[model samples]
Target: MRVIFAGGGTGGHLYPALAVAEELSSRDPGFEALFVGTSRGIESRVVPASGYGLELISSRGARGKGAAGKAVTGAMLAAGTFQAMGIIRRFKPDLVFGSGGYASVAAVCAGWLMRKTVVLQEQNSVPGLANRTLAPMARRLYLGFEKARGYFRRGAPVVVTGNPLRGAIKPGPDRDARKDFGLSGDGPVLLVFGGSQGAMTLSRAAAGYLLRRTDVQAII
Candidate 1:
């Protein structure tokens, strides 16, 4: 079966889609999956490395912008819709997974318009605009946080499946991980990951706290 995975611009959106794609491939050796994302998104680098065919689409966010910015975003979204429609027609995918980002808006809409099965996965405490807008049309909705249910329309087929993370993101003994990282496991351990690109604000806050408390053993 052919499937299309759409979403990017951030690890929050991209990683979940990757995880799902991985699962799909594992389930069926013949299953084919294609990734749709914007050229500027991290997907340009990450998707190809993951061994998935990546298709580029033009998309921009419409939220938190002035009139001009909104207009530009709208135009981009329109163009992206046409591009996504073309991809959908050519691919003839059995299913389309929307991973929640501005990059996913057009693809998901196109899939729905084409009457293909569309599933949406939301990874945030609060659903983003793209997911919220597509929720009503999605055949199924997977949410990372239960709190997000209230944001969607009632009677939507929402399921709290939590975030779909990569296979490498498994839980293990902290001490072993610390030792592997060349850190002593004898003291308190603080593991801080600031996403793929590194969250500067979170890094600074963690640094400030560590500076104030030298007794804490941190793996940032």
Candidate 2:
């Protein structure tokens, strides 16, 4: 099987796409997997690190810019679309899978145009713009949240698959985390991590609000 996965911009999108690629490889050892992503995004690093050959297309989003910037971004997007087509023509994948990002946008569109099956994974409570735009062209759309299904048009592929996670860490609830952290029960417990979605703002606010609370015990 020849499979191509195009996704990037964040680990949330890239990780699941990679997981699917891994599964595909396991199902068929003869499978050939290729990843398409922007040279600028995190996918360039993460995709190759996952041991897949990555084809980089030039892509940039239009945001917080004037008309000139938007025009330039549009031109870049069009050019990258052509580049994606080129990749598809050369690779001739049987199917293409992606998550969500500008990178996925170009590749999925090209794959659809080339008469290849396209599968997309939309992994958020609210589907991202790229995934939504590419949804109609997709043969299958895997979703993380069920509520997001209505957003797609009629006959669009919508599968409610819970979030695909990797290298998950689940600390036992009965493990007595207080003892592990050497904490006292006199004060509230505050946990902070920078990487979680919308986490920084919530973590800071939670830390500030609960640090003074003498009764709360939780994880953030």
Question: Best lDDT goes to which candidate?
Answer: 1
For candidate 1, which ten residues in a row score worst on lDDT?
189-198
Taking all chains together, each candidate's TM-score versus the true structure is 0.88, 0.83
Looking at model 2, report the run of 10 residues with the lowest lDDT sum: 166-175
Best by TM-score: 1
lDDT of 2 at 139: 80
What is each predicted model's overall lDDT from 0 to 1? Answer: 0.90, 0.82
For model 2, how does the per-residue alpha-carbon lDDT over 69-94 read when each residue is reduced to its tens digit? 89887888788889999999999899
Model 2, position 109, has a per-residue lDDT of 78
Give candidate 1's error at residue 27 in angstroms.
1.0
In the range 59-109, model 1's lDDT, one tens digit per residue, is 987765688888888889889989999999999999999998899999998
**Residue 213 error, candidate 1, Å:** 5.6
